[model samples]
Target: MSEVLVVRGEMQPWTDHTARQPVLAALLADVIPANRRTLILGPHSPLLIESVLAHSADVTILVRSVSDAEQLTETFGPCLHVVAGALDGLKRAAAVQPTLFEVATDGVQPFEVVVAADGLDRVLGYDSEHLSWTERLAAVRSLATPDAVVVLGLRNEFSMLNLLDRRPAHLRHGDDEWVPLHDDPTRPVSVDQFQAALPWPAQLYADFSAHTLVGVEAAATARPGHLPTRLAVAALESVDTPLLTSTTEPLESAARAGLLPAVPTSWLAVCNAPTPHTLYTHSGPTTLKATATETGWETTVGVVTPDLLGTVGYDSTVVPARVPGGESVETVLFRLAAAEDVPGFRKLAAALGEWAEDSRVLLRWDDVIVAGDTFAFGISGWVAPESVDKDDLLAAAWLRFHRRLVDGHRRHPWPPWMIGDELVSTWLSMSGVTLVDPTPATAPHVESAYAEQLAWGKQLAAALSVVLDSPEQTHPDLRTQLADADRARLELTELQGHVFGLERTLGFRNKAMKTRENRIRELRGQLQKATTANNKIHSSRCYALARRLAQFRNPRKVAAKARRILRQNLNKLRPAS
Candidate 1:
């Protein structure tokens, strides 16, 4: 059996067991049409193949090792077009040297779709001399049709994950030069930068750690408004993302519209040339419908109208009102506004501006405007613009996203204990961030420390037991004190059980009292109704007589009827005599 190729201390032939695969596949299924010829670089995942096959597309998998190719051929049979060779060699033959492709079994034909499922990382590590990001991307493009869709799975560097995981080290294989890999381009390019990098226009979908590709112009201004609620909540709760609140803008218009700021670790990029299509994006052609006011600009998004800048609850009761966008970008500058952290807001805005366009930073008084309270300060909302997959890819992506949330929560537990921090507590409420795990850190040292403490505790308890039991080590008074303590502990345990029983009995009695009280109230109501009827009867003389008659009529008629019957019987008896 051929051993799997290892890179950077990880197996290259297989994909990580992540939820991203299904999500990416689902996204791909949505974008790529069935019956299209697809070129898959790096069969890093069986899920990638399954996603491609789901659409019944013409599939081709290119692997670097001969053993991998042979194994794939056996596993998938003749249906799979498995090719073995280095990407650099293929690039040299097809592009650099103008030679025929070794894997061109049925002759080279332009592929309608090309997927870098293994991502640039694996592709970069395929040979001794890794390919540059631009060259690798260009080489992948060469296998595509004129207007074929190009999908790239990218990692986001700005994610909260990077802050915790600092494990990147690049070194030359032969030379001892310790430098970052050529493939290690500053990741997570903006939508504009990403488009500029590509020969064709493209859109980006990013989370905290990952992104996906889609065609340009596919990103609608309103796309962020319609994400899944769970997905939206994840984004909103993300402390790493500044404009996660932008998702709530669409919620005002429609409840079913999806939520945002997914913080997913993987990204998907779609390049459209042959067929232009729409894809979801965070930032798109957002038109700021704002009207200039005496103090500042009044903004409107979705159904929320006349959003007065630097004001709290000015339009609290107001419905949709008219507002117009000025030619200039809206920037609500604040100076000495009550309770407004102008400096902090500016700092945060500067940080966020790195990822967004037309970066207008504003400070508004946050917190509810109480009847008497005069001051409030915080961030209310922020907007961001930006820009998935086949079915198996989508399923994998969904699974990955879910796992990320679950595992992420497991990693960095929510701060329920940090309720004292108003900002953090409030952010938790507004954002969809929830408690995944309550345990502390999950790192090796953290776990090891816990284990050590537990062992120490057990040892301490055993030592205490031994010391207490050993007559040689213990004083007579100490032994007597220990016996007394044991007796007290037993007494306390018995008292606790007795108290528990009493508490249950008290609860039952309380319920019975409540039941009696309700019954008494019902009877009182009935008595009140009867008294009212009696008063009504007494108020009218005729009604009183009719009511009395109703009460006595039946007895009086029965007595009168019995006397008449007796008289008739006496008359008949006399005649018979």
Candidate 2:
């Protein structure tokens, strides 16, 4: 028997984003390499598949598993008996139409238009069991030639969460004795199953840009001709999926060995090809572990990768509902307090209950949080900082926050919330600050708080900074201090001038008094001698007069020396008044 064509299902868009991000389309444009034959298995978004098929015709497209007999019986009836249930479907289909599955579009697909739907499903990943599904898929693809690009298309059901198996909304066991796996009880209808119904002339396409990989040209005729003109299988890897050519050294492609997504026999046909168990063991969800280390505590949640399930690790966990004190867990947060409220800054702690909400409009970011006097929050999300150019949207968000805060503060007088700046919030914070450490205990709380704080803090900090740094008060304290210093200096200058003048005047007066006595004594001797007593008797009298003058004139040399000393000393003092 030729290889049986077993596919999961297909998706078609009634709306837009679905086609824009069609699984196969992305794989074709991205992960799937050029010129390779691949069998895309899974129920598909019909519109999405068609869009992928747009103007491209090289690869093969597998529609459904041979085992889905029920879906077939309900839709097509006994005509497709061999391919009824998911199991039988794969077995019989592969027998007849195996080789003609689909063709690769030479990696070239041209499209007229591509548009996004308003409401997009959350990117795939989910349920603890999904880990096995991912692993199986990877293992199956490994069987294909390493040089050949293998594309695995996931439905929205295989959500981002599916990568780990967070309990699917609904989980069940599909009968596959050969495989020990279960269906997601929560959502049996996966993204792949969600197909774009092409009624009559209506059709849906998946190319987001101007190009297309696979397009479905369908019309209600005698039978469904899934034989795509060019069966193109686009590959999908996580956005970060490494290129196969990235140096063929130990290119350890990771797979969630645990997720047991139901695969068609076509996939099982190649499962053994990758040497399934030789390289890395297929993984399954192991239970979370709670262990103690020297560093206080540690706990892991739901699923941990690269480790065998049930492997022990250290971390903390917020007890779920039935646990006491857990009910109050409104949120996890990194609290940024005002300078004054440094210690036990609990406003954010308190705000957790407020921010933890079920709406997407809310800021849902938290991943890591460094806790201390204040907290730092972070998340694991990609942001195209350069691509963001919506100033108005930023402004609008800010306005909404402020308006909300105002209403909240009025409604309930609690933590006085404040709004932050718009520009920062819009451009800078859209690419956020990552939390240093994240814990499951803080997941709900942190996620909400991170979102709220970034949105709030960016706006608040920007606005406050601008206002405080305004020309009016940027240098208030320095300007005031400078003005005071200038005034004090001027007063000191006036006082110095007055003090110098008084000192000079007092010194001059003392010198004048001291010299007066010397002058009188010198003149006295001259006056008493008069004319040496006009004659002979006077000449005798002149001697007595000369005797009196002799006391003051005894040391003319000393007197001259004293006068010189006085002048020099006075000159050393400040100028005389």
Tens digits of per-residue lDDT, candidate 2, 1-577, equal 2232333221221111222333233333323333343433333344444443443334333332333323323543322222212212332344455444221235322211121121111211121123344344332333334343333322333322233322333442222122333353322233123231111122222221112122211101101101111011111211222122211111111111211122110111111112111000001122222222232123333333332111121111221111111101111211122233423324443333233322211121222132343222221111111222233223333343344333222232224332333322332233232232323445543443335435533443244323212233222233234556786887789878878888898889879977997898988888778656555564586777776667675488868888999999989896757
Name the candidate that leads on TM-score.
1
- Candidate 1: regions farther than 4 A off: 1-20, 65-71, 91-109, 124-128, 164-188, 207-266, 273-577
lDDT of each: 0.42, 0.29
Residue-level lDDT tens digits of model 1 in 513-535 = 99999999999999999999988
- Residue 496, candidate 1: Cα error in Å is 26
Least accurate stretch of 10 residues (summed lDDT) in model 1? 383-392
Which stretches of model 2 miss by more than 4 angstroms?
1-24, 63-143, 153-397, 402-577
The positional error of residue 404 in candidate 1, measured at the CA in angstroms, is 18
Model 1's alpha-carbon lDDT is 0.42
